[model samples]
Target: MTTVGNRSITLEDFYQILFKDNAIEISPAAQKRVSDCFAFLLDFAKEKLIYGINTGFGPMAQYRIDEHEQAQLQYNLIRSHCAGQGKPIDTVYVKALMVARLNTFLRGKSGVHPDVVALLTAFINRDIFPVIFEHGSVGASGDLVQLAHLALGLIGEGKMWHEGRQVPASEVLAAHNLTPLSVHLREGLALMNGTSVMTGIGVVNLIHSRNLLNWSLVSSSLLSEIVESYDDHYSAELNEAKHHPGQQQVAAQMRAILQDSDLVRKRHEHLYDKKVTADVLEDKVQEFYSIRCVPQILGPVYDTIASATTVVMHEINSVSDNPIIDKDKGSVYHGGNFHGDYVSLEMDKLKIAITKLSMLAERQLNFLLNNKLNNKLPPFVNLGRLGFNLGMQGAQFVATSTVAENQTFSFPMYVHSIPNNNDNQDIVSMGTNSAQITSKVIENTYQVLAVQLLTTIQAVDYLGFEDRLSSVSREVYQQLRALVPVFTEDGIMTEKILKIKEFIQAEHVQLPASVVGQPAAVAATELVAS
Candidate 1:
């Protein structure tokens, strides 16, 4: 089924809307819930004692104020928090934040009126996103500052980007037959304090990063086999002895992919056989830890994506609003469930996994480039020109730089909490920085793997006409070859590498990662049994 925007927002739907160019919908039930919250707040405003109504917020939640000065309170809350510094986040991420914020309000517990929810929902379905900055949220009080800007925009009070045009939210809404929304009771706080900002970013980034891990494996293993490393390194017996389930899966997959290769033959003792060279048994003796230790590493990547996904999925589906309704008890429970610690922990782990994958990709490229280690290939696969080939020096440089950046991104942002709001938020999650960093890590990872692909195709050319690769590897080479021709003269490797990256992204890279990470990989037993 095509993913539409609603509470049922899965990672696939997220991919569809965020990356795959799919549209979304605002369900009727969700609209009703949103409308109900807004209506309740409007009637409840008669009691100005409501915290965040005609009263000061946060550390001053107990302070009472005159109803006449109430409108300025909401505006003041947004303007003061607009202190977010640093470059703006990607526009797509900003849209995700809007969608998530709108969805949470749909759960009907926030007491926001239906009209306000309908407006936010319309913004999502119609692709209208508020301008949100990157560095404002401390992530403890739930992406406070950035989301305040979003809330302000929802009420037609802040600025937004609409249909490729930037305009004041009040003007845009007015132009579209709308008006600034009424914020009564806890409506402003309901819109502002939640994990929507970070959770939306976390899911989109983690899923994409997870997909890149798959691509990194595909690129790395292609280079590993091209270098003619022993298939024995992927033996099930070795992995089974270690008994790591992930490693077992990786070894098995490698064995399966390399199954029917003519290249995997036993050495013949005949003198005539000596004339034809196969992969050297000694130099190919032990595959490097980068290739052999893949499952052990990428297993963690898989785990990170899964773990983060679970937390974010729940965050999106449920009512993250404070003072959650309890019709059964006829009361509300105000709590800190809105705190984003869960998302922070998962994002930090994701950052590490992404960094590891980028480094592995760069390491794979280095192996392919080092002629001394790559069996008999020229340094940097000089591509038969020796003196004339520009080769993959530039691709290698980019891969190195990208991986370095990923390492820098992996530093845990969650640990650095700053006090805010009169010591009320003495501790924080920094989930905002964590999620944003996770996004950057994924981008760096893409560039790193792109370079590895360029170098791997070069290594494949250098290993030509040898004892052939397995049918599967041969087929994969065929796909890659469609984009990257043999690097015989090295005209422009950059475009080729980029095109291959696009190809890899177009298809979900899951199966290929499994193929390379075959922890249960065993030797070719078919011909021996035959």
Candidate 2:
């Protein structure tokens, strides 16, 4: 079991709970602080006017609530904003959101009743995910609509996902013998007003995007080997001259992957040692930019992921609630900590980086399919009679179209704010929208790479290059080829393409320890197992 609220939750804790099914328990210290904060707020609000407690919210804040109707006000806030539209977010992401919210509450700055923490912990450990939507939340004022749905579920008033089916939150709660949250002081506002929803989705995007980069690096390494390209492009002597750490690291990782390969040529041994007789050499001096400049191209992507991780991880551990309650100081301070500019900008940048990565994969795939560019294999790497087979020609359309879609979807959401709530929220951050779009871009890139990997293996088979590949490349080739056989004739490849995409996304590629902060591998292994 992973203990929450004892220390800050790391990305590793998230991975274990969300992916590995680890249960969570709230620490006693956090629980006592939550209770103390609630006690303080209950007394503090008895004679004083507090925002969202005694007054109306947003533009309606001037209107005050009567003492008899204060509890109803909280419930009304929750149910009214439960008006989110569009497809429900996936269960895994909703779980992440719940975890983020719970951690914020655990900080004891939200004045939430300890029951809120208990319910959220129960929901996460039992896998009872609230049905959160993708379309709501301008990401200012703290993912209002999306988190309203979360608040609704906790109050046993909305739908939830349980055991792979949509069910009433009340029924699920009863079955588990759990009590619904009763609003005390500002429980509803505390739950609904924060950046946890956007931050949660951004966290999920970070993990998948990092995994995609690892696979892309794997694909690029194998592509270099397939063309018998020169090793100097990824050499330390060449990359070290540039001061960017990401570039040098990428080059070093490539060398580690290609270190034992028999296919990659040494520039000094090939061209420098021998005298050239022909005016125009048969061997092209250097490969295409996509093949040779991988370190430079992907280096920025590495830096972007690193930068986003630092910001998101900090956001995860922060208390993003409005009107931070301080029992220790005997005071409450109100501010816009809920604003999501940090996450919104990072998500926008992350998607743009991923889109570029996909474009690189498409270009590499193009190089392999074009016989004129490569001068090595048949067009489209078709192994059958050239004209009749058509080979991977049809699948290239999917990759091209998908990359185009990603390019269009890469528009930044951070600057696209429109005033709403009668212009009360004149400036807002559409951070949730940014995170959702970034997830789509990441998913699309995986599909593009799926096509690229399938095509690459086809080219490898055509030249019988498996035996001469580096051990890492050989292992990846064998696993992928096992999923889809070499095609000699034109056939429906939709299912095969889907299979490869699923494989790439489901199985974490074991990159060098320096590359991904994990142990380097000589054999294929799942990241969790390693």
Candidate 3:
């Protein structure tokens, strides 16, 4: 269990320790540390007139502030920067963002009052997450706008949705018997001058993109087996000849996935004219380039995602807060630690991988939908031509449309930057926008995958008991068969598609017992089986 009150803070703590136990409170030790640091910062400001403490910030740094106006300066900073503009994220994610920001502040290096920590701790304990928009963060200068929106509600200056109604933060805090902080210190800068939102979302996106890549491989293997694709695309010699690490890895995985498929040729027999295979007589045959090049199309996306995950994990564990207080030197030097270029680039790559996978799944669905393309399979993988078996027309439509939407969303937001913050923030990273874009790309992938799942199952039934699917795909087929049986008529496919979506994201695939050693979960299971 992760408790903010009873633990020492560390990078490791944020990555693995703080989850499941969301109850956050300042322990006596943490309170003392925060109090001591806040006192030091105030002393420093009084003596030195630090850049943003006793004076105005950014372009107005030269303007001096009176003692009575210091609190107002910080308040003004929060009020002016609440510029986020988009749909709110999942409550779970909002909670995660809160946790990330709180944990970073608890390091006692951000110069915020202890009472401010207590206020955030209360929000975490009570599950009162502030609504934050996806847009408005430039990913440079610490997600300023989004963090400002988050802080506004904390100061009772903005509205927050609670118990199904938008209400003032003051009322919610009063009702819950929690008090807002009396002294406005560096809490606004502390909250805003960090990469918590990008880091939080990036870490989660890393995990998801990795799993989605695996599922893409799993899905690709299934389609190849269903269409009886050639072994040429995955040959070790072919990939080794060029040896791009990502491409080689993907080809290897494809080979492993189709290892025991009887349909894979022992050798290439003849010309493929889209309608036939081996240029010989066979009802069941090798499919066209769309099906044959499954590995070629999907393998690179998988590799790119894996590489991106590695980069993102390192980034999440990083200390990305500005003005990092040095205990030994007793100085707080402001720097661009929160600049989002690194994160945004990786997220852009994530967008590409996600969009490509959705496109691959859509292509597979197209192959299964066309009888001429699907060899001798029934129209739309229908088990009966006389209206007895329902085709996967609805599911196919969803996959196609979902892919189209994903393509549109993949437009790079990071490339679009503008000067703002009185020109102090001239060039922006838009890292948060990159993260938001990738999130939608991930959702589009789910929709596309759901459709492919429906088509694969339908195609299996179309083949009937006469043809045995590959060992890997057959196991996957059985799992779906248990939930969604062969559609005897044109019934609702939405429910079935939804079910498959849940199963993949939940990692419900099974591992073979015959494997020498492997984890029991489908993550290891599907990889080994494939």
Candidate 4:
């Protein structure tokens, strides 16, 4: 069981809550803090006028709502803001959004009742996910529209995904022997006003992006071995001079992945050995940029993902709602923590990094297919009759097109905000859109990397070095080859490419222990085992 509000939550905790069905228990201290905060709000409500407690919302805030009708006002706010449109997001994301929102309330500043927090926890524990739409959030003033739909599910008014089916929340609650919640005071506003959607989606994207980075490292290492490239470029002396942590880390992992390889030649061995001629030695002296600059190109991507992880973890644990209740000071503070600019900008950077990674993979695929650049490999990587078989030629075209599409998706969504909310929100951060596009780019990159790995395995088989690959590279090649056979003659490759993509995204391919973080590596293994 996972305990909320006891300490800061990590990305692994969120993953457990979303995927592992880990039950959540709000810490007793957190319950007391929430109770104390709510009690203070009730006491202060008699003597003062508070925003969202007795006043209207947004542009209507100028109009004063009567104290008796405040409850009605809060209820109406949730129903009216359930104006989200487009397709429903995955249930895992909805559950993640709930977890993010609940963590904010756990800070004891949102002024929500302890029961509200408990109910949210129950939703997660029971796998009751709210049906949240993909659109309708400006990512400022919170993910108002989508979160409002979540708020409706909490009150048993909207649709929910339960037992693998979308059903009315009321029916699901009834079946589970649960009662719908009654909003009191500012509870509805507390629920709907936050950056939960953006943060939740960003967290999920960050997790997948980390996995993708690990796989890209594996793919790049495999490419190095397949091309029989020089390992001097990844020498420790060279990377240490660069003084980049990510660059140094990549160099170490690449060296480990390519350890004990018969194919990858040392500079001195190729230069001094009498068996090799000057022409062959010159060709082995330097590789193309794609193979030569693996660390230089992918190193910054590693650092960017690390930076994005920091920003996302902070956002998940932050109190992003308005009108924060301070029990100690006995006052309410209205601030703009709901703005998602931090997450939006970080996600934008992540997409660009992922796109660059995909471009590198596509270039490597091109190198492997072209006979001249491939170090005397057969044309089109075909092992059969030259003109009769096309091998992975069609698949290479698909990979190139996907990389181009990813480039287009790399355009920053943060720069294209439009004013909304009756012009009250003049500049908005399209954070949800940014996260969504980041996910799409990652999906496309997976296919690109899949094409690269598939082509590498085919090339390895054609070169008759399948049994002589580096230990780690052999494990990765065998794992992929078990799922997808080498293409001797090209037929319909769509299914084979997708199967490889599934293996990549599923993280079934084992990477060098040094490349993947300890926690993530364990998680991936556990996920595959389960």
- Residue-level lDDT of model 4, residues 299-319, one tens digit each, is 888788878878888998989
> What value does the lDDT take at residue 112 in candidate 4?
88
Question: Where does candidate 2 stray beyond 4 Å?
Answer: 507-530
Candidate 3 stretches greater than 4 Å from native: 2-40, 106-108, 115-122, 156-167, 171-177, 182-184, 230-232, 235-242, 251-265, 268-287, 384-390, 465-472, 507-530
Candidate 4 or 2, higher TM-score? 2
TM-score of each: 0.84, 0.96, 0.82, 0.95
- Please give the lDDT score at residue 487 for candidate 3: 72
Better of 3 and 4 by TM-score: 4
lDDT by candidate, in order shown: 0.69, 0.87, 0.69, 0.84
Model 1 spans > 4 angstroms off: 1-8, 35-48, 162-165, 170-180, 235-237, 240-245, 248-283, 465-479, 490-497, 502-530
Distance from true location, Cα of 368 in model 2, Å: 0.8
On TM-score, the leading prediction is 2
- TM-score, predicted candidate 1 vs. hidden true structure: 0.84
Ranking under TM-score, best-scoring first?
A: 2, 4, 1, 3
* Alpha carbon lDDT at 183, candidate 1: 61
Per-residue lDDT of candidate 3, residues 1-530 (tens digit): 35563454432233332333435556676677677777777766666767666778778889988878878888888888887777876655566666667766666677787777778777877777677788778888878877887788777667666986767888887888877655455666777887778766775565456557666666677776666666776788877887466666667766766677766654446344333435556644445666666556766665666556555545544456667655436777778888888878888988987898788778777877887776657777776554655577656777877788889888887787888879888988888888877987887788788788777777767666314666666776787788788776777777888888877765324334332123222232123213
Better of 2 and 4 by lDDT: 2
Error of 3 at 326 (Å): 2.2
Identify the leading candidate in terms of lDDT: 2
